[model samples]
Target: MMLTNAVLCLLIGYVGSHGRQEMFSVLVCIQTVVFVCCETVLYDAGLYRWQLFIITCVIAAYTFQRLHLSKKLPLRLSCFCMSLYLSKATIVLIEHFVFHPNKVPVYSYVTILFLVFMIIRIFVTEFDTNAHSFTGHLGLLCVSVIVNANPLIYVLSSYIFMTESAASDIAGLCSMVCGVLIIIAQSIHVPEDLRVRYTGVLGIFLGLVFIVFRPNLTPTLYSVFQWIEVFSVISFVIVMVTDSVTQFLQIMLCSAVLGLCPGFRAAIMLYPEDNIPVSGVLLFMLSSCIITCIILCFIKAQHLKHTFEKRFIKMSTMLAVVSMVAVISDISTRENHQMFLTLPSLKLILCANLVISICLKLLALRQIGELLPLTEPKDDKEVPYLPTIGNIATFISFVMICLMAPTSSFYHDVWCCGASLVLVCLQKDMRIFSSLREDNQTTATKITSLVILVTATLYRSDIWNYNSSWMFARGVTEIILVLFSIPNCYILWGLLYDNVLVLNEQIVIFTLPLNFPLILYSSSYTGWALAAAGIVSSIWMMFAKFALQPYHDDY
Candidate 1:
């Protein structure tokens, strides 16, 4: 609420009569921060002072207009800010792909800093201890500023001479800034509620700047999503326990990439033909994510008396992935008699890479288990625990994506983006199948969940999109066009499912006929399958959660 008041004050101050003075001040603050980050980190993202001035003026004008309204706007301001951000980011992304093909797209300084500020605000709202929350938030902001400033310093310093080390120095400096931030932030014991809230934003930006930046880092579904769980779930615990900025940075970077599977796929598809094998490995990693989820779910289910075969689940999943790879390879090789790629070799290579990955991960998990707990309970009796159902259903949705290998055809980019947002914002107690457990509903929870789900559903349905069509039959542009079908089943499901993410009387009635083969066959097999799996999984997990409650003696 303090943060809310501060934002209101800040908003009101900008809109009031002394507009230019205050408005210009924020621009100066942003530019100064940008200059510092560029000079220090050598991350020379395009930041024209004139452009900053223009954007500042535009936003200020909009704020002034909005301030004329008597009532306060919740999503309007935030969504306005985010919509502008998405526009800028999209422009940047397009520019990166077109003009600057090699370089990763960097975000605007305002967006980055705003996210940092947002993280702090979220912590204030979620965490109980005022001192820790305030200081923790400040420390995070400080680290972001310092780290960003270092990059600016390095970039400006390199303008003197075209020396390569200067650039490397900048990149290293930026990396170091991230490292320093993590170390400092972790020094304090951040509270539990705040950690969960902060991780979603942190994980994303970190993923943008840090994790995906690694030269040799391979994209795997398991690795990427697990990384998300770290920021979304584990980071919350770490923040609560150690409160280290260093660890938090790592968690944030991880989470950012988790929801970016479609982006990652696009990246892989663009890789050189020789590196096609890498795509398979990347995909296998994605499948292995299910394995990891299965492991987590199985453990939880066993403790809670849910039935899932340990050996069979493991073997079946592996075999299914392997069999699919084999099938794809056979079809690909046969089809490639006149094409560019040898699908069979790539498939074999991918499977091999995946198997090796699983073994290595098993080894890593063996040792890392001691360093982390599976889950951290918040406020002993307040925030209900996230059951195995939520995790499993989400995994199911994800697994379907991999199984069908949905391209822009069915599970379009919008769908991927939607699901990812819902996931990263998901609470420890909320299941992907249902909504917030009544034992732990907060105002923030409703707002965050509502925004993500609504956005995701719209995106998933391709309602806001202009070129949304389904391709069912092979050759000719055969498709289903249902753009903006309002008062939709998805909305109803969201409303009903939001309260309890599992199977119950309400879910069973809605989900029963919904999951039948007829409806499933209606949409693109690949897209709808994943969507249906997500829905069905939610129901299954919820029912199973209740059934297994008697068995969970340890938890």
Candidate 2:
């Protein structure tokens, strides 16, 4: 497993250093050989932190040494270091939260590989290989360094305590302070006065330093503060880079937002009887505030307004409702891992607040998306592939967020798929309501919609148990969600057929119900009626698309 991670890290570094697609297959072969050799010779050895660190350092060296490594060596090295630190941080996080120390298994290896692969893929893809903007690279470097410094800060603090080395402690402190100043400097836009920026930065640095190094603080509290600091730094970085909020930046920023959600879940540890070190209420409040602010800033960003749609609002609302319901259900049934005593009214209020907040922000997003553009770029340059890639990544992140919601009811599955279908509708210019504008339709489109609607109606009785009634409801929800995808399927196909997109419609169409599991759970009849209405509306919409097809000819 260690060797596999090592090889994977190396492959990722190689790819990052050389941003060409042609040599990707060759790198794959190298990874395979490294994996096979390591398995053959080092299978009996235990993985060690020192070994991983050494391998990372070696890769960093090699990455810096490569051809066409056009970026400044220091800058590239810093990025690689941050990437490696993030990868290690990921493994440490998984070990602490997801897996037991003594239970290192094959599945753990697979998960580690997947995590490393994703982090690497994101870094390599989002990185401006051409180095188009100096400030952009600097911003990324600064953010990564600030995030990467947390672990080091902890390690150095521990070392200072253990070794009683005043010199070492002072050196480390100075370096971190310098790092913070650099971040602030990079974060400033052109003509932005450095005096004001540094003043703000100095204030931020003092607060963070105080929180981090405050005496008598518990380990758990310290960790929480560290995360808060990182979250703030990320927010600052995003704001700084708003001018260049390209697809890569958007996706990176969104992914960071999603990654921070679980940290907010730590609020569950606040119960007195839980024996958790921190105040759960404080944790939850801090997390909620941070998350709300972050979401608001992200959705309201001037650069990202064009990328969102009405369906995104619907998707966010549905996911939030499902999550809230799942949490409430778990608490009511005493199925929650956190044994905190929560009142039903309190739960309902929390649930409603979360849903309403998300919906309101999403509504703002939709409004922004609909607003007229100031001016399209006159340069004949095509839109980059990065935006589409970012959209897909954001959708994946949404799916993961939905799946993370703890729920025993089939509502979780139903809503997750429903949200994903909404994502399909939101892609590019395609919208849930955009079918109203399209005048052209084919006979095949009508037939396809008819088949889907009838098939869903007919399968309800056989697949879902009527005695339970929720099964029927689940069936209807599935039907409605699929039916919603019917017109979207045509929209996506039209885009593909028109050469607006290089990919086929099936990519988005097939994923409509991909997360929806085969089994159904019992629930209320409300889902059924809603889903039935949705199905009927979807059928009507499909017919409308066909009926209105000829109207455009006269205009």
TM-scores, one per candidate: 0.26, 0.25
Which candidate should be chosen as best, given lDDT against the real structure? 2
Question: Scored by Cα lDDT, where does model 1 land?
Answer: 0.40
Residue 305 in model 1: shift from native, Å? 6.8
lDDT of 2 at 50: 36
lDDT of 1 by residue, 1-555 (tens): 334445655664565445554454344334333433332233233334434534644574355335424233333343344334334433343334434532422543454445444443433223334665655665565455455443243444355335643333454345444544544444433434455335444534443333243322257865564345434443333433342423323333443444244324433543445545544545444544433343333223323221222332444456456547644644443433433333433433334334333332342233243332333334655532323333343434433333333455434533444444323222333333244443433423333333333333334442233343342231121122112111233433444445433323444344444334323333344434434544554465446533433434666
The segments of candidate 1 whose C-alpha lies over 4 angstroms from its true place after superposition are 1-130, 133-137, 140-179, 185-267, 270-315, 318-555
All candidates: CA RMSD in angstroms?
29.2, 29.0
Compared with the true structure, what per-residue lDDT tens digits does model 2 show for residues 1-555? 555758676776787567554455345445544543453344234443535544654564355334224543334333344344445445444445545543444444434444334334333434433334534544444344344343333444555566433432443454455455444443533224454355446545544444444323245875565556555555545545455443434544553554343334444432334343333343344334434433544444445444433323433444344445545544554434644324222342343334344433344345454463322343555543322332443444444445454563444444444444323322332332224222322322333333433343444433356555666676566555545544544554454234243344334434434323222321333334334433443344445432333334555
The residue-level lDDT of candidate 1 at 292 comes to 35
Error of 2 at 96 (Å): 48
